[model samples]
Target: MSQISKVVLKDVDGNVLHPQTDAGIVSVNDAAGSPSNVQSEIQALREKQSEMANIDFFVNKGDVNSDADLPAQDYKNGWAYY
Candidate 1:
C-alpha cells in the first residue's frame, strides 16, 4: 500500500510558503518544495561515492606494465602514484 506524506515550508517569519504531502510522511525544507533538486543532489552524491570507491591508493604508479611488473618507484606518494 502507498503512504501519504505532508511537507511544509515556512520562511523566517514562520509563514508557510509551500505545504505538500506525499506517501505517508512530510518533508519540510527548501529542497522539499522542488524534489528534483534533492534527487539531483542524491545522484551527485552517488556519483562521488562511486568515484571514491574506484580509487586505488596503494598502487605505486598509475600505469601497469603487463600486470606482472610493479609500477615505477617514482610513483611512491599516495596521491602522486594514484
Candidate 2:
C-alpha cells in the first residue's frame, strides 16, 4: 500500500501542468520517491555491520575539534562507541 499527501501532474518536458503558485517543487531532478531493491540493501548493510568491530566504550574526554593531542595515545576524534 502507498500513502500520498499530495500528487503532481507534470508534462512530458517535466513542467508542472497546473502548479499552485504558493506551492513549490523542493526535490532534486534525480531524487527517488522510494527506495529500490530494499531486501538486497538490508542484507548488504547487515553483512557490513557484522564485519565491523563493536567498540562499546571509550575513556577519552576532550574537545574533538581541536588539533591538540587527545587524552589517550590512540583517541583521535574516535566517537563514544556504538
Would you estimate the TM-scores of all the predictions? 0.36, 0.25
Please give, for residues 30-67, the per-residue lDDT of candidate 1 as tens digits: 33465443334454567789999998766344544466
- Per-residue lDDT of model 2, residues 1-82, tens digit only: 2222344668899999866421123332222444334333444456668777575446446455547554465544545422
Q: Give me the runs in candidate 1 sitting further than 4 Å from their true place.
A: 1-7, 21-36, 61-82
Identify the runs in model 2 with alpha carbons over 4 angstroms from their true place: 1-36, 54-75, 78-82
Global lDDT for candidate 2? 0.47
For model 1, give the RMSD to the true fold.
Answer: 8.5
